[model samples]
Target: MSTPDTVTVDGPGLRDDPSRPGPVDVPALLAHSRETVGPALRAAVARLDVSSREQAEYHLGWVEADGSPGRGGGKAVRPALALLSAAAAGAPAETGLAGAVAVELVHNFSLVHDDLMDGDRERRHRPTVWARWGAASAILCGDGLLTLATEVLLEDRSPHAAAAARLVAVTTRELIRGQAEDVAFERRADVGVDECLTMAAGKTGSLLATSAAIGAVLAGAPTAAVRGLSDYGMAVGMAFQLVDDLLGIWGDPAVTGKPVLSDLRSRKKSLPVTFAVQRGGAAGRELAAWLAHTGEQTDAELRAAADLVERGGGREWAGAEARRRMVAAERALAGAGLAAGPHAELLALGHHLIDREF
Candidate 1:
């Protein structure tokens, strides 16, 4: 997984500065999201069986393994995007509440399943749901979240309620396909750049696109706005994933909450890995040899692979690709016809997304 730097929104600027902290206060934003989306999320999972509900709550960062309060949730980006999209369309932020909560639930659902498939045991500095409560509980918790996503939307009773439910379901399918492709890529030595990009779009872009589009749908925004926001979300998602891919290879372990070269150690075919492999250069050959002979990579071997990825032009190419996608996302957002206030925040977020140290 890609983990970028800690991002704080300071007004129109997405960059972090201690002197003149702008409006993109990440903590404030998350607090706002929790205020808006928390109630629905809680009620949705309230009916689950004791163990499943406990796991779900634990995964959501509401409680710990022993039912104590825990600081364990994600960045809440999807929900923020949904609410921001609604505001951009001149609707009250409250108007997109259901959409925001639903997307968040779906996001967590994917995280649970992905962790299990990857055999990952840690996230956000805590044991993964599967690690703490067995894989069965994790699976059941993910299913509960998925079902609750639709259930919450169904409770909205607006004209767009059914539509929102349908959109999430479809996006979830796309997410699953993307994840399947990612796992498949791990088994193949011949992964290509184009295929990797497609997988990134599928795995990461689909749900973000839904997050952006659902707000417009719920607010009864024009069809054009929805399409534009969807494209914008996809572009942002692509950039976000590329940045994440970069961090996977070179990110600071302290900031990312994962070991250095974690992706290489796990033998995952990230964009850089795939790009280097497809380069067919000396470095690419060396990297391939290391990969092919892998049982458990020593730290030194992982470092060597990272060096080879850079030497093969993978690092430079991914950085360039990330910048390109950032530009594309901005253009897409411009076409979204959002109000000036919301547009500024979203644009700043786009900037913040690409420029972080975590």
Candidate 2:
């Protein structure tokens, strides 16, 4: 969602050299991800019945059995990170393809169940799997994907397979726990900023850490370097969630592909709103009154709530926090001592995440 920051680099830097080009093209990265992962996913889905498999493939934006292309695939950022990290760590990029695919499959599995639990009707501008096929079917499909992800990891015979397995298992549990905490926060009036950050780290950060760790492992990087990449991923992931919280309140529907004020309408305990509530002033009191009101909020009420969040300095605080995390991520990447180009790209990506408007 974020754009790249402009840097006045001397000679040889990404923006300075006319021949070196600018930031990585996200669409090209996505295309590479699809080329590497798509066939394997299709093969895994072949074990299912025609209807179930069709539905699963549709969710992935693959062709149905009838060979018609489906809709709504995502940007594949996780897999791209995995593959890029591998390359940055000195292995052939293709060496990490299996790990990339596995991580992405697990991510999609979680997303399917998450949409069901949240009763979200749409994803990637299309009806969610649960919305189209029913909760039972969606659950089964998600489970199947999870199983396949583990199988893919096993098939790769990674030297650090045990560690990768442990990471995924732990990440999955934390994901559930974070989601539960999020749901619980919706009913409570006193959600703390620290608690919200903890939930965000567990839910969004853990898997990203795993993605980078797995890539480093596959590349046979030293333990210290692997750990550094994991830490970098965690920091970047937190920054991403903070930016997402900002977008949930202020982003254009066209850019985010979601309705404006949707998080407010759902009464989500996002960082900005929670901070505003904790500030406890005129804005906080007005927000509390709105929360207690029996009726649903009109557009004006939602706008007022957003204004309260902004006035309370929640947005500013979150933006600063995201920037801080980006700095931490850059330090971690430097600690890993990876090649200059990929490190530059990763730093650019981190800046983009923190600075994005949508």
Candidate 3:
């Protein structure tokens, strides 16, 4: 668990310290979100068929491959965001439980498919579902999770359930479109910054936007508030992806759960790499030439590529862009009609996503 540079946890429970000024105790906030959402999530998973259930249980870190107690569940960022958005709309966090579980299911669905598509055999220090079982099981698990994400929302009795469900369907399409663009970019040498931003908006931003908006929609928030929350989530998501790109090239492998310079090794034209490629400096030219090589890249070669990305101004630009997006997120929330506490927490969480090395 990493803390943003702006928040602290020196108070009782979820309350902030009165002496210092910042967001509430975020660790506590997230823990509360996870606790609040866990039973519903588990109930949904329990409804799955045996094979799918086993894979979901393992992948969600609720149980080990051997069915023992374990933990690999992610940070619960989506769920926390959903719950906070509910509160922002003047409802209790539990009012957003369905949305929280739905977004989380969608997120895990994407992760299962991502690992298989990337041929990644490990995640959270465990064998990936495909590696442990087989590709068929992994595929089935992802399908089951995606189906459940919609069912969760539809099953809700709220008057807004239908609209929220529709948003989920639309967001999923956008997510897949983004994923398709990402896969296509992996093979092309001419990925531009604008298209990359567009891809990221879909791949990462849409789901997050839904997570922030669906809860409020379920609570029947006014349209302007919902739109502001959605915009805030999108800005935060974009900043999150930019920071993730930096981590891919320069973060500690132990912290990132990927090898050092993993993006460079795979020749991924991430935002930073795209910036470098478009800069057209000597370092950028060398990086472009090296990326054109379709053969395996050595560790030394990967290090040199990271160097080129930095020298070409990619690294600095990414950091600056992330900060810029965070600023935009703050602006988006100015008139959001959010509860003061939840609003502060939302801003804190967004900063946390970009500020941490992980």
Q: Per-residue CA lDDT of candidate 2, range 168-212, in tens?
A: 778778877888988887788778889999999888998888776
Give the clash total for candidate 1.
12
TM-score of 2: 0.89
Q: Is candidate 1 or candidate 3 better by TM-score?
A: 3
> Tell me, what's the RMSD of every candidate?
4.1, 3.5, 3.0
Better of 1 and 2 by TM-score: 1
C-alpha TM-scores of all predictions: 0.91, 0.89, 0.93
**Lowest lDDT 10-mer window, candidate 2?**
7-16
Q: In candidate 1, where is summed lDDT lowest over 10 consecutive residues?
A: 9-18
Per-candidate Cα lDDT values, in order, are 0.81, 0.75, 0.86
Ranking by lDDT: 3, 1, 2
Highest TM-score: give the candidate number. 3
Candidate 3 — which residues are off by over 4 angstroms? 1-23
Instruction: For residues 1-358, write the lDDT of model 3, one tens digit per residue.
Output: 2335455333222233434555476677788888889999999999999999999999999999887897758889999899888878878766788999999999999999989988999998899999999999999999999999999999998899989889889999999999999999888888888999999999999999889888899999999889999999998999899999999999999888788999887778899999898884899889899889888878998998999999999999998988888888888887787777677778777776777764
lDDT of 1 by residue, 1-358 (tens): 1322333333332222324644555556556767777787788789788888888888888887776787657768888788878877877767788999899999999999999998989887789999988888889989988998998898985688898899999999999999999898878888889998999998999999988778778888888788888888898889888888889989999877778998898777888888898884999888888888858877998898899999989899888888888778778878877766566666665566667573
TM-score of 1: 0.91
Winner on lDDT between 1 and 2 is 1
TM-score of 3: 0.93
